[model samples]
Target: MKKLLQIIIGLGFILTPFYTNAHVKWFTEVAPKKESIENILSPLFMGLALLAAVVLASLTIIIPKMAQMPLIKKWDDYLSGFRKYSRYLLKYGTAVALIIQVTNGTLFAPEFQLDSTLLTVLAWVTIGLLLVPHHIATKLGASILLILFIMVTVKHGIFYMLDYGFYVAIIGVLLVGSTKLENVGFPFLYLGTGLSLCWVAVEKWVYPTMSLDIVANHQVPTFGFEPAAFIVMAAFVEFVVGYLLVVGILNRVLGFVVTTIFILTTMLFGFTEIIGHFMIHIVLIIFIIEGVSFYNPPIKMHKTRVDQFIFIFLNFIFVLSTFVLIYYRFA
Candidate 1:
């Protein structure tokens, strides 16, 4: 058990900078286009849109009510017993995500591949360390990841790298890896994800063109809205959900919904989406079951409503203006 703890700690380090690969729509690696709502709507599309809204509304009303049923509650209680395995999931999943990224030659983007064969090889080594399932090996993996992330950051600059969202996964790895801090790993992971979602949303805000390309290419079904509006609204949803995760609000429902969305996306986009969002899927799974922490995490995080609001506001500005300014100045 002690050795396992060490492995977990080491695994944490391996997750340092989880940049979305060049083709990944979830984390970054962007797309979408500018077909206006005014231009695209027809009677059939309008009917479909209304049907979608009705279905969404119905599900919103129904699923939670069903979740509270005795059988469902019993099942949830049963699942709670196995939540401990999420520890392994977090560690191994990170390794696999790294493997996918390395194999693809981009962080998560097949389009934005690394030029250096050496870095590619090093990424494989990181995967090997994650698979070791021991602290010492995991530590080695983390160390390697740290170096990789740092190198990437230096080249990309501190201001506006979409890869920065990887910090949450890093925190999860370290927290769960530590004997002293393992219990709080889930919360910190949630915080990291929240921050990541908001940060990625900024990418859409600044680079709407990238989002437009994605929406159009994916045939993501914008209902009657302009593709660009859909992209912006999608970013908002991403930001709010991340905020909710960070603030520990409606965590289970949000997690479950997000996980379902990712699953649907994987089906839509196939193997690349699977590779790109593997880590995200694991974290959401954890959130769906774990919901929040077993302990107070991040050392004095969110003790009150005011604290949550303050965090939400500050993070919003940080993700929005901070990145936008960097983009205008640097890129």
Candidate 2:
């Protein structure tokens, strides 16, 4: 067991440099070109997909037992104590992200510039409401944030705005946090953000050229793999992160690793990286603090190890195929 933990940690250290969370579309001018279906279904892609499914399924089965270890349990308990502050962290962190966007003349992300004066004013108003310290004010702030999102959708099509779906989830978190159903907010947050990330990972497969272009433009290290292969591995890494979030596995540990990877990217991508991922960083911190306290993860329902493994393996394949095919068809 100790050896297994060491191997996982070692692999994480090796892969950390390649695990980029920056949305390629935000950094590159993506052409309308799509990867050939043949390439999408290549041996390499399918093999990696299967490998990822097996690895994640194994984690889903193993992580519960690992969590019961004296050291892990103690650390998790310490982190779980901060669950009460999850809402505050999300709220204020979003406030800071909005402030950065407003100052930079953008909306939800750096790519979507503020195209009109109304959006600029609304952005400021949303920030003000977020700062007001009252539940009503925060709800109003979330409402305005929704309005801003809709406005962006109107300007750009729904397809473009889907990349920012996590913002909608954030708004949901804020709105629900003030209601009697506040407990549901975190699970909703988890679902929305997780699905959003999974959706975005599809883009890397469908539009590999964009990611490859970003790698070339930014001189990102590939660590000896071809750029294409690296992108595949990177996308898989991101998809697994999102999947674990949805299933509530390794909440704090995943949060810590992903947060570290994002911070490392800033050294390569600079202020733009920080601006693009600031809200994500905040949400990860919340994950580290909350550690699945309010939710019963799906994998936990299967009592036997064999049942859990089968459930995770099949579930991963279904989700991966569904997402890839749907995104390809749309693209």
Candidate 3:
């Protein structure tokens, strides 16, 4: 009973709305009168819901165990069944940490005024978590993460969906790779992830500053500056980083720098461009994990048909979008 309650509490932490209250606050502050109530009460309701769940879970653990019921004994058995696999835990945990660090630092850190140095520290922290063995606590971590990610992506739309897709793919790869499938079709996975980043980079070139100032202004800013310079720089960064990422070169360094830039943009201007920074932060984390230096994955399987299909799809979207952004910016 106690174990089950603990798991329930852990899950609550993941799904609770208060976790993203900052975003809600920003939205409510900017929303018109009609939507103000949603902005105000949504997070509050969520917080209360989670609090209730936590309290209930605590009672389940404390009351039943003290009473020594058969139900509690049965619950403990079920809890014991969900044991953590240490090696798998380390590999996967490190992978997640890397992704989160990059997302927060590079893609979204700037919005928060965080330093790039903090990214490095976070990277290490994530890596350290992997070194430790998985406990029921780790399982709890994974479960909450999975649930929160699912909910956030669903609420956010295609951009969020794609973000979740990539994350899921990475998690699947890590979980599968930790087993005998270590030498399996890994390059394709990295390639897919890299292509996505590269595409975004290409768009950046045409909108150096990502027209971030306009985002800060909460409306598109007047485009009086020479957009050409920014566009060129963005393109160069995107192409170089994209190509290198796929080829497996200087991943950690690149990830650090990329995430740093993202953080800068968001902290500096993301409030006005809420969705932009939100999506960017999510991608930055994925990129960082893909770029981490600690683990050396041996190549076994080449790109399969499904992998090729995704590659083509992403390539088309990125290339088409890049040209469109460029044309629009110049026009």
True-vs-predicted CA distance for residue 287, candidate 3, Å: 10
TM-score of each: 0.69, 0.91, 0.37
Model 2 lDDT-worst window of ten: 11-20
- State the displacement of the C-alpha of residue 284, model 2, in Å, after optimal TM-score superposition: 0.8
Q: How would you encode candidate 1's per-residue C-alpha lDDT over 182-227 as one tens digit per residue?
A: 6656666777777776666555655667767666776767889988
TM-score of 2: 0.91
Per-residue lDDT over 126-221 for candidate 3, one digit per residue giving the tens place of the 0 to 100 score: 445444455443334334344444544554554424422444444444445435664432454455555555544433323334233333444422
Full ranking by TM-score: 2, 1, 3
Model 1: ten consecutive residues of lowest lDDT: 14-23
Q: Residue 326 deviation, candidate 3, in Å?
A: 14
> Which one is best on TM-score?
2
Tell me the lDDT of model 1 at 324.
46
- Between candidates 2 and 3, the one scoring higher on TM-score is 2
Instruction: Give all candidates' CA lDDT scores.
Output: 0.59, 0.81, 0.40
Q: Ranking under lDDT, best-scoring first? A: 2, 1, 3
